[model samples]
Every structure is written in structure tokens, then in C-alpha cells.
Target: KRVGEDLNRHVTTDGSKAEWDAQDVGLMNQVNFDESTMPIPLCSCTGVPRQCYKWGNGGWQSSCCTTTLSLYPLPQMPNKRHARMGGRKMSGSVFTRLLSRLAADGHDLSIPLDLKNYWAKHGTNRYITIK
Candidate 1:
């Protein structure tokens, strides 16, 4: 959720680059088959240690990662039209950066391209203009 929302990696506090390993992300980060998200601490920031990335959240998950639904407040299966996410035009956006990292990690992105909308309907948003 944080990644899709463009938040920093290992981000303890919201909207900051502060990297922390403590399980203090509150209730928002945890989910079933979390390994699917590959939440490894791939950082080499000034204060972070290299060895720290070797472990944490490690285990074997038999759960079908994609079949698993979302987290908290309201959990539901992905929409029926659920398909891979793609960018209209690639740039330095967080979405692209995440995709880049995934690709760099040797992920097979075969035919993983599609055009899509660029709008959002955030939960905190209340003013949806009606036509």
C-alpha cells in the first residue's frame, strides 16, 4: 500500500526518507503472503548496515500470493478486472521506480504492459464532482 502510494522504503514515519527496521509501521504494512511484496531492506543509506538486509520476514509461504486479498479496515479480493499495472509514460515517479527495482532484481516482466488511467480516488477524499 505504501509503495503504491509512493512512500519511502522502510519508511517509519509517513512522508519522510527516514529508514527504520523496527516493526513500527503500525497495522498498515503486514499482510498474508507478504513475501510476495518482497519487503526486503535493500538500502545502503548512511546509517543503515549492509548485513541488515540478509534476514527478517523470512519464511516459506504456501499461500497463493496474488490470490490473497488486501489488508485492514476492509479486506476484499482484487477487482474482477484485476490486471497488471502499467504506466502511460515512464518517468521518475515512484511507481516507475518501484517497477525499475523489480526489473533490476531480474523479475520476468513478460508482456506486463498496459495502458491505464492516471486518476485516483483516495479514501480521505470526499469531494467527487458529479456531472
Candidate 2:
């Protein structure tokens, strides 16, 4: 059975921090007519022609088309999280797993992620919320 008064209460989505207008949204969808080059400031590409990408791997990489970067490791989890992968991290593929289950409420960890209780009992600005 479903539980908790918090779960029963209605909640609205938080205000967007970007607060983009129509013009700002359109800026992202602009068509690039030139295949040989991209516009300045918008693209700092050094990798491929006709690429509209901004910067690659903090400006050190050639293009977004190729990547040698590995993302930071996943949040702490219980044992056997990646049993099939032999304890090695799955890199950027956390969401790429085809399995039906991936994460949990984190109530049992040193850093619990129960969201509701994740914790009013502990603190704010947790790792998951960081950019």
C-alpha cells in the first residue's frame, strides 16, 4: 500500500532557473546553412567540419563527436550494484541500462537518497542536485 502524508499532498514543479523566452528557445534551433564552417562564439569546434557543437571536453577535446572522458563514479550503493560488470563503473551508461530497476530510495546508505527523507533528517544541496 502507498504510504505517507507527504506522498498524498499535491506538489507543483519548481520554477525554472533559466526562465528562457521564445527568442532564447529559438536560438538553440537555428539552422546552419554552412556545412564548411560554424558560427563564432556558438561553436568553438576544432574537430569536424559543419559541426555546430560548442566546446569539447572543457575545450581540450577536438570535437563532441569523439570522447575519451569518463564521468565521475556513481553515488555510493549497496553491494552487487554492478555484479555483472565486476565492480567497475559503467561510466555514462547509468541510464543506458535496459534493466527495469536502477536506483532506490537510498534509505540504507551512509548517504541516503530517500528524497522525502533523503533528508530533512540530514541536509540540502546533495550530490544528485549538483550540476
Candidate 3:
């Protein structure tokens, strides 16, 4: 059974120092796009004549044909949210596994050097000391 009132109930609108200041706290808005009207760019190619020659007052004849190309920007893919985190909480087991994997991948799990030194010097245990 839930012990306390919903956390949302405690939220206050009064802009005060003591009150919890909650701003920009909500699910990320989804991106909207109009698919039908959006134009998809196309690629096109054309052939051009090179080295034209005139023979006996006849129309010029082309020796070789050069290819002309037109390239257009690709259309943007519709944005999609893979997973929605609304009102969902991560279990402790999942959190532990994530942290363990991160640590195995060389992520730092040690305390800061300055804090470690301070604790070594002034902490309750006398045996601990920084080398």
C-alpha cells in the first residue's frame, strides 16, 4: 500500500524560496510532421553532346556524349521516440546491472581524488592514508 499522498499533490505554484521549485518538469513533447505535403527531392541525369562537328553544311554531329547529373538533398526521416519513460521507474536490479556494465567499460567508480585525500587525512579511521 502507498504510504504518502501522490508526489504531484505536494507541488505548489507559489514562487517562494522554501517551496520546491519545479520548472521544465514534464515528458518531452513529440515531434510532429506533415508527410503528404512534404516534398521528397529527386535525382536526375541528362546526356549532353561534346565535340560537335559540321559536315558539308549539314547540322553538327556530336562525337561523344557527356552525362549531366542533378543531385537533390534527401528528405528527413520522421522522428520517433524509441521508448517512452512517462511514469515508469527503473528497478534496482536494472540500475545495478547498468552501473556494473558501465564500471566494466572503464567508467570511473572511484571517489574524487581531493575528497579521497581529505577523507584519508581527517576521517575517523587512523589507518587510512593517501600515498
Candidate 4:
């Protein structure tokens, strides 16, 4: 019931409870068959060594590495009005340089490529493509 409660209460905007309730039906549209599991990927920072894995079978697994949370938040996206309001195109060199800097700073870059081999070895999200 905790997960359900989290889904119901924590998943939506603060003042739109009724709207959330009506739309929450869509959340169940993608229910899975066999359970899937993901260990929180290892921290890519050179000094930190481990992280915890939340398993599908209802257990927490731990390791020595630490994780670096992205400056960008998950689920929530940048506002559309704010997205390119700075007068920059998506593929501009400034954006490319920023991404490269972020990658060098240890941001994971693999999410776009959809590669599993890199993930299998280092865990999820330690390398990302800046280009």
C-alpha cells in the first residue's frame, strides 16, 4: 500500500488532487509481467565507490560506490517556454560544450544510446554521450 500511497499522493501537483485522481488511472496502463530490478548505478566520481540497489523482490542491496544525482531532476522537465527562451538552438555548440563539460564532470551519458552493455558492467548511468 505504500507504493500505491506514494503514487496517489506524491506523484501529482499539490493543488490538483481531483485532477490527479482522475488521471491516475493511466499510471497503471504499463503494469509489468515478471518483476524487474535495477541497482542504483555506481557513483562515477573517482573517489566515491558505491551505491544501493533497490531490488524488485523487495530488498535493498548495497555497495561501496556513491551516486551523483544530476543537477536536472527526474520526471519533471524544463518548462517549454524556458526551454529555448535563451535564443539558443538545441544543437548549438554552447549546448554541446556544456554537455561535454557535464560528462567530464561525471554525468552519465548512456540514457540516449539505450546501450545495455555499458550498464551491465558499471551499473546504470555512469557514462553519457555529450554529442
Candidate 3, residues 1-131, lDDT tens digits: the string is 27875775555556432242233222232111122532211112213212222212222211221122112221222342332111112233322333344344564544211111011111111111111
Task: Give all TM-scores, in the order shown.
Answer: 0.22, 0.15, 0.18, 0.18
Instruction: Give the Cα lDDT of each candidate.
Output: 0.27, 0.21, 0.25, 0.30
On a 0 to 100 scale, what is the lDDT of residue 73 in model 4?
A: 16
Per-residue error for 13 in candidate 1, Å, reads 11
Native-referenced Cα lDDT, model 1:
0.27
Looking at model 3, residue 99 earns an lDDT score of 36
**Runs with alpha carbons beyond 4 Å of true place in candidate 1:** 1-92, 111-122, 126-131
Summarize candidate 2's per-residue lDDT along 18-100 as a digit string, tens digits: 22111132323333222244222121222222222222221211111112221222233244443211111111121111011
In terms of TM-score, which candidate is strongest? Answer: 1
Winner of 1 and 4 under TM-score: 1
Candidate 3: give the clashing pairs.
Answer: none
- Candidate 4 residue 60 C-alpha distance from true site, Å: 39
Worst lDDT 10-window in candidate 1: 59-68
- The regions of model 4 sitting more than 4 angstroms off are 1-88, 112-131
Candidate of highest lDDT = 4
lDDT of 1 by residue, 1-131 (tens): 64478554544664333432332433343322233453422212222322111111332111111122221212222442332222112122333333444455565444232212111112221111111
